[model samples]
Target: MKIWGYLSALTVAILFGVWFSLDKTLLGYLHPIVLASATYLIASCFLFIINFSPLKKKILKIINSKSKVEDFITKKEYGILFLTAIFGSVIAPAIYLNGLNRITAVNAALLANVEILFIILIGVFFLKEHVKRKDIVGFVFLLIGAIFLSTNNLQNIHFDASLFGSILVIVSCFFWSMDTSLSKFLSHKSNIIYITALKCAIGGLILLLISISLGLSFSLPLDKLPLLLFIGLVCLSISLPLIYFAIRIIGSTRTGSIFALSSLFGAITAFLVLGEPLTVTQLSFGVLMIIGVYILYMGDNDQNV
Candidate 1:
């Protein structure tokens, strides 16, 4: 991993840390589906404004050069892009936000670190990436930390609502893992801005249609529009592209390992911004997660993974 790789990972961690906490706050004002749809819609609009001209010129340049546009973005890439939209921007957000509504932002952020596990699984099996012993050890630490956070340090053992919420977050991470791997591949095919923009636009449209079918309220307070814009621009637009760039540079597993820091950043941000209490258990498990991520960082070699 290069310095830019590390920078991208840390930047995404901080951005998503604040974004996840604000997501919990927004859930109070808007339904999960509605908020997801609206925010992504805003992101789509922002991307269009920023990239439409550049993308148009690029496409025309390709045409003028007598190269097949398909050479740049093929049918298979389109298919992968559609899947990324469905899983990344649509289903993953819906499930994660629903789970976030059920649980604390701190817990949601912590469990989201499990995305690295799923990403590794997918990479090793489907993508045929090699995993090392140190990677496994780091994963163990992260798993233990996640278990501690989910179980509240062994205080809550039963399969209660909190457990269910944790499961939902885990499942959401699984989908996001799929999205991350596919998006990494896609980054080689197209500009991250174009891919992120188009995916969010299509996914937002789908979610909005679903919200309409489900008769969910579409109304948002006048004061909250700016917050939604901030989320769209900062979280979805800027942060997502950076994550894709990191995935391209460092691979999903390494990127995700560094992304585990989002839990620590998110928990602290939730405490400060949302006034969520930072309990001893949360803090302890957060430290454990940081240790796990540090191990992961140490384990990475000078290679791309």
Candidate 2:
């Protein structure tokens, strides 16, 4: 079961990497906000169907019966959860997808490593979680690697599409870091299914409204409907639920490390699928990012034992 959990985490990362690649392709036809809203809406429906199924009834009952205070959840708990969805799911993806349109997938993936640093800062200062000295060193290496990859196109920065894209990706990382920590707290009381469903549903609905208010065209690309549905089902619905379950079993530190692996997967997918060039800077930084995550994972295990 534990091995399954680790595999699931890795699988989620790989699936997300695929999603990022495909999503970039799809962006030519659909707006980022529309894509994100549609993906999450489909995911919500999928989760709701399973939650209402007979097989899930017993689990649902146990989750509902768990008292918030006793389980470290309260009315305030739901508030934080909802905000996490708003920022992390709704806002973050919208920004990221739009940003990816302007950036190479490899750079986007490398820049995402910034989330680890944000997570560490949040854990130590805001959440009051302990951070080992080794973790700081690991983060420093990761940051340096990310910086190297980001500046590879320094001479072309003005001509490159990645300038604004990188900023959006960093913002997305902040929201994601917050979401990860908050979800860790909420998972103690709520069924992973319940929390995931609620987040997607609420977040999707909010994005839908925002899309409408902004007068963003929601016209479906008739020819691309199949691709859209495939993304919605496999990437959004299946990957997210399994990700939550992985978080439950592995703890957030390990989960974060595994999640970071998505960058590697993204880089490879981008090279193959998007015909993007892979540069030496990207290669060097990618290895550094992976090593940094491995160190974090190792540190987490040592502390746990």
Candidate 3:
């Protein structure tokens, strides 16, 4: 079961890596807020189908034996769920899309590694989740690898528009770290589908309102619809559910640390998807990140033992 948890985290890393890579191109077509709103709204609709589908009650019965049909989660848990929607689904995507607009896909993916550091801190200090020395050492390697990949032999470093964008991406990571910790706790108290659907719907609505208020263009290019649907279904819907499930089993620290590899996955995919050059230095950094994830996984296995 724990092995499955690790695999689920890996799957999330890959899917989100693809998303981060692909979204950079989408940003060229749509406003950041508009794209964020559309993706979340579409994902919410897909989740709604599942939430009220014919198989819903049966699936809920299998997954949530303790949950009453009417009210399984308390009010306090509901409040926390609302926070997850605000931070995770709403604010994080907004900031991330903004950053992705300013920077290249590879840079955005590399900077996303900061999310691991934030998650580890929250998981350790606030949540009182245990992490071994080995875990810290592994994350340190991940940090170094991300920096290396981002700088690319320390060439053309500038503190201008790109730097601000990187900062925005880091801020987005902080909110997401909060979301991961909160969602981990809530996953045990509520059904995963319910939690996911509510977050998506509420957050999507909030973003939609913001977009409308700002007079952002809501017109979806007919050509971009396929890409938007892919982001909605594969990345937002499937990826988020896997993330919540992994968090429930392995805890936020392990899951977030594993997600550091999204940078590596994104870098590899960029070669094929975006026609980005994959240099030897990038390849080396990717290898180091893989080792970091392996070290974290070993620490988790030791804890389970």
For every model shown, the clashing-pair count is 0, 0, 0
TM-score of each: 0.89, 0.88, 0.88
Report lDDT (CA) for all predictions. Answer: 0.79, 0.75, 0.78
TM-score for predicted model 2 compared with the true structure: 0.88
Question: How high is the lDDT of residue 280 in model 3?
Answer: 81
Best by lDDT: 1
Question: Tens digit of lDDT per residue, candidate 1, span 108-168?
Answer: 8888888877877787789777777776776787789788877777777898888777778
Query: Which regions of candidate 3 fall more than 4 Å away from where they truly are?
Result: 61-71, 130-132, 150-152, 301-305
Residues 162-270 of candidate 2 have per-residue lDDT tens digits of: 5667778778888887777666666555466766788899988998998888888778768878878888778877777666666666666566667788888888888
Judged by TM-score, which candidate is best? 1
Worst lDDT window (10 residues) for model 2? 62-71
Cα deviation at 66, candidate 2, in Å, is 17
Writing each residue's lDDT as its tens digit, candidate 3 over 1-305 gives 56767898999999989988888878878888888888888888898888888767786565455432334788888899899999988899999989888877777776777787787678678867678888778788777875665555555366667766877888898999899878766756445776787889989999999999999887767898898899898788887777776776676777887888888788767778998777786677667766776776673543421
**Can you rank all candidates by TM-score, best first?**
1, 3, 2
Q: What's the C-alpha lDDT at position 112 in model 1?
A: 81
Model 2, residue 290: C-alpha shift (Å): 1.2
